[model samples]
Target: MTQTKRRWRVSPATIAPVLIISWAVTSAIATGFNFRPLVLLELQTQALFFRLRGEVAPPPELVILAIDDDSLTRGRDAKELKELASIRSWPWRRTAYAEAIDKIMAAGARSVAVDVLWDLPSERPADDQRLQQTLKRYAGRVTLAAIHATSESIGGGLDQLVYPDPMFQVDPKAIGLINYSPEPDGQLRRFASVYLNQIDADLRQSKSDLLSFDEASLQTSKLPFNAPKGDYIFFYGGSNTFAIVPFWTVLYPQNWERLKQEQIFKDKIVLIGPTAAFLQDIHPTPFGDLSGIEVHANAIATLLEDRAIAEVMPDPAWRGFYLFLALAGIGLAIGQVSKRTTPRFVLAIVIAGGWWLVGYASFVYGGLILPVAAPFLAISLSGLFYLSTGAANDQLEKLRLRRTLERYVAKPIVKEILSQPEDFQALLQGRKLNAAVLFCDIRGFTTLSYKLPPETLVSLLNTYLNAMVEAVAAASGTIDKFIGDAVMAEFGSPVSYGEETDAMNAIRAALGMRQALAALRSQWQQEGKTLLYHGIGISYGEVIAGNIGSLRRLEYTVIGDTVNVASRVEGLTKSFWTDILITDALYQRVQEHVEVVFVGEHLLRGREDSPSRLYSLIGLKGEAPTLYHQVHEELRRYLGYIEATES
Candidate 1:
C-alpha cells in the first residue's frame, strides 16, 4: 500500500482573529494596568539579559560613603567612644555625621546627599546645632534625606512628607524622598523620581514648592529628567558595585591624609547612609538584596546618565498589537502546515524561539522592555489548538472514506485504502489497468422468482447474494456490483498483489461460490425449500475501472471487452453444463495452481473474429473427484491420444 498524501488546510480567518483577541484580552486581565506581575517578570528577564550580557561600568562621579560595619564596630569599640557616647549605641550623635559631612564637602565633592533621616531632634542641643550649622554652611550644595509618607501616614494631611526638626533648619532642596518602592514581589526593580503631589498639598504650598533631592540635584547639574513621572525601572548591578567609603574614614582626623591623597571623592556626588548588616535597610533587587544606600546610589547613577529602561510598550494598546501580530503570524504558519506531527511540532518550537528572540533583541539593543512570556504563550497555544483540530479533521476524513469504501470492498482492503488513500482515489477516477473480472449469475432466476411468493423470493435472493459477497470478500476480491441475482467482482485493479495471485484468487472465489450454492441446495432439499445454484465466469485483461452512472449515484465497476467476455461466458455455463468457466487468458495464469479441462475455442460476443478458448475448472490437483470428475478424466485421456498421434 502506498502512503496517503498529506493535504494542508488552513482554518478560517475568523479562527485566528478570535483566538488573538482572546489571548490579548486574557493578557490584559492577568497583568492589570498597574498591578504588574507580568511587567515584573519582564523586568526580571531584562535583568538576566543584562547580567548575561555583562555589567555596564558605573559612573565615577557618584560615590557612596556608607557607615558600614567597621564604622559601627570601631565607633562602638573605641574606649573614648564608650565613655563619651551617652547612648552607647549604634547611632552615636548627629555631631558625628555632621563632622563627616563637613569633611566630605571640604574634599571638593560636587554634592552631598545624606541618606540618613533626621526626623527627630538629637538629645543634646549642641549636636543639633552643629548639624544645623553644617547644613547652613553648604545650603544649596547639600541635600538631606526624608522618609516617604507610608500608608500609616494617611492622616498627615496630604503633604505625605517627613522632614527634619525645625531647629536643624535643613535646606528643603537637600530633602530627597528616599522611596525606592519595590514590586509586589518584594523586589526593588524601579526608582520613583518624584512622589505624589500630596506632599505639596500638605505643605500649604503649590505642587511646585515640593521637589525631591533627586530633582534638585538634576536641576543643580543643569540636567533634565527624561523619564516619565511616578516610577521607572532603574538598572542595578550587583551589590557594592559603587565606590564606597567608611563614614569614620572621612570623620576621623588620622585618615585625612590618605583620603586627600586618594581624591576619590573629588567633584563626585556623595551619598551618606548606613551599610551595616544589623541595620535592616536591605531590600531584594534583581541583582541581589542591597542596602538602602546602594539602592539610592543606583537611582542616582540612572539619573546622572538618564539611562532608564525605556518601555517599548507604554500602553495596553501597544501590547495588544504585539499579541495580534504574534498570533496572526504563528497561527497562519501553523494552519498551512500539513496534518503531520513532525512538521507541526517543529513549527511550534520555531514560533516560540522566534518570539523570544524578538523580545530579547528589542531589550538589549534598544533599552526597551518588550513583553515576551505572554506573546510566546499565545503563539504556542494557538499552534497547539490548530494542530489538534487538524488531527481531528484528518481522522474524520479517513472515517468517511472508510464508510464509502467498505461497501464495495473487504474490511482489510478498506483499512488499507484509508491508511494509504493516494492510489485509491486514482482508482475511483477512471483508469485502465489489468485485472481479473469474475461474473456470477443464478441459473433460471426469473422462473425461480415467479414460483415463490414475493417475500420468499426476496429472502432467497438476499441469502444467495450474501453468500456470494462473503466468498468474494474471503478471496480479497472487490465487489463491482450486483445485477438482480448476478454478482460482479474484480481483482488486481483497485489494489494489486500481482497478476498470478489475482487470477488464482478469482478462480478460488468462483469455486467457493459454487460450493456454497451446492451446500444451500442440499440444506433446502432436506427442509423442502426452493434450491439455488450459481454459475461463474472469469476473464483477465485490461479494462476501465472507475465510478459509473449519474453524479448523484455512482456504481464502482469495470468496463471493456474483458468484463463483457466474462459476462458472456457466465451466460454459456447452462449450455456447457458446467458450474464454472474461464477464458484461456485466466486459465493460463492459474494452470500451474489448479486442474482444468479445455472446453474448445468459442467466439465471445464482441470478439467474433478472434475466438478465445474456454475451459471448465476442476478441483485443486488431487483434492477431490466432485461433479466434474468424469470430464477431468476424459480430458486427460483425450490430450494423451492427441499427443501420441502428433508424435
Candidate 2:
C-alpha cells in the first residue's frame, strides 16, 4: 500500500487569540505594577518628539531682561560708568532692580516680573526704601517671586512660604511662588497655575490658593490666561527662546535710547532674572538645561497662547487605546494570510513607523500627547512571541518528518535528509540518479509454507524479513518495500556517498543478510523448525528515484532498469545454484573491496536480445573466509560440471 505525506500548517485564527491575550496580560501587569521603565521610556520618547519639532518661535509679547555674565562683567569692569559700578558681583543692591523696573515701566512695558526674591531688607535702608517705593508705584503691574520651602523636620513638606519683604509687598496677588515641579527624572516638564498648600493645615482647610509666578505675571498683565489647572508646558524652544535685553543695557542711558528707538519693551511682558550660570537657577528640560527665567517665560507663554499639551491616555475612556494599538501592531506583524517571516517583519516595522508619525503629528498639530514606549514594547513582545512560536513549530515539523523518513531509511540517511530539508524535499518529487539497488528473496518460502501451518509460515517469514531489514539499515540502505518473502532496498538514491560507496554498501548489506540467514537456519535446525535460505541481487545503474503514485497515496522507491535488473539477478540465483549475485555494473564499482566470480552472460527475463554479464559475490577482500567462500568453491565445481555436461 502507498503512503500519503502529511503537511502541517499554522492557522492565523489560532494564533490571534494567543497574541491578544498576551498583550492584554502584559498591559495589565504594566498598568497595575506601574512599570517605571515604560514610564521613563514614554518621557524619553516625548523628549524625542520635542527634538524633532526643533525650535519654535516664542510669542513676541514676552521678553526676558537677563542679568547675564556680560552685564555682570561690564558692571564691575566699566569704571567709566560710575553709576553701574555698584552693580558688580552677586547680590547687587536692590536699588539696581528698582532702577531697572523704573526704566522698563517707562518704556511702555505691559508688565515687569522680577524672578528674584527679596525675602530680606537690604543693608542700605535708603536702597530698600527706593525699591519698595518703586514696587508700590507699579503695585498691580509688578509680580515678585516667592518660594515654597520644605521644612527640615520630620515629614518634609511645603511648611514655609517665603515671600518678598513686607515693605516690597505692594499687591497681595502679585507675589507668586517660583517653585518648579520636576519629574522623577529631575526634568522640568509640567507647570501648575495654582498650588494648594496641602502641608499647611490652615491653608489646606481654608481652600486658599497659592499662584505660580507665571500665573501672577499673566494676571498682573491683564492678559487672558486659558491654561488648564495643571498641564505640560508646550515649550517654544530651548535656551534663548525668548528675546533677552541685558539688565545693564535696559538701565544704561546709551542702551536705553537704543531700546526705546526699537520699542523693545513696548507692550511686552518683561521678566527680570539672572541668566548667568553662576546664579545657579538652571534646570534640565526636554531641549536642554535652561535658566529659571526662560522656564517661567515659556510657562507664561503657554498659558497666554493656550497651548498646553493634554495627555489623552490618562483618561479612563482612552485607556484601551494602548491595547488597540498593540493589537493592531501585532496583527500587522503576525496575523498575515501568508506565513512568510520577512513580509511580516517589514509590516511590523511599517506599523511602528506609522505610529511614531501619528504621535509626532498629533503632538505638533493638535497639542496632544500620546504614549510611545508601552505600545512599542507591546508590539515588540508580540513579535518575539510569534517568532519563537514559529521556530518551535518548525522544529516539531522537522521532528515529525524525521520520524516518518526513518521508517523507510536508516538513521544516518534520515539525518542527511533532515540536514538539508529543502534539497530533500526537492529530491522526493523525483530525480534520475545513479544508485545501487538490492533485492533479496527467501529461496524455498513456497515449499516451506506448504509443509508448515499458516501461522508458522507467517511467523517464519516475518523473522526472515526483519533480519534482512536490519542488514540493509546497518549499511545505510533505504528499505524500499517488502513483497511477501522478498525485500527490496536501495543505496545512494535519496542521499549518496558516491557511486563506489553505494555499490560497496549494497554488497556489504547482501553479505550481512547471508550471515544473518545462516545463523537463523542453524537456530531453526536445533529447534527442529523449518529453516530458510535466501538469495540477494545487487545492481548499480542510473534509475528514477522518488515518491511515486497519486498525491493521496505515494511510495518512495526507485524504478527503471537498475531495479528491474536487480530483481532479475535475484531470480537468476536459483538457476546458478548460488545465494548472492551482482550485475557487471555493480561489480565494476565494488571490485577492489569485494571478491566475486564471473557467472555466465545471459539475457535478463524481460530482454531477450542483449545478454548481460553477471557475477556471484563471494566475500570481502580483507575479511577472513566465511560461508560465502565455501559457497564460491561449490559454485565453481558446479559450473565446471554443468559446462562438461553441456559440451
> Whole-model Cα lDDT per candidate?
0.73, 0.80
User: Per-residue lDDT of 536-627 in model 1, one digit per residue for the tens?
Assistant: 89999999988788855776778998999999998876656677899999988999888887889998788899988999887667678575
lDDT of 2: 0.80
lDDT of 1 at 117: 78
Candidate 2 local lDDT, residue 343: 51
Clashing pairs in 2: none
Clashing pairs in 1: 143-174, 144-174, 158-198, 159-199, 159-202, 176-213
Model 1: ten consecutive residues of lowest lDDT:
195-204
Cα lDDT tens digits for candidate 2, 1-647? 99977876565435644775667566645644556765677788888899999999988999999999989988888778867865875689888998989988998999999999999987899999999889888989999988877667566554667878888887654877787778667788888443433346675444255578888899889988775633788888999989998889976788889999999999999999989998999999998999999999998998988888877666533455455655654665355644644455556556667767888888877888776566666655555555665556556656766766787788978887788736334667778999999999876566566778999888888888888889999999999988988999999968899999888899889988988888887898899987676778889999998878885677788999989999999998867778899999998898888887898898998877889899988789988766986655555565555456556
- Residue 376, model 1: lDDT of 72
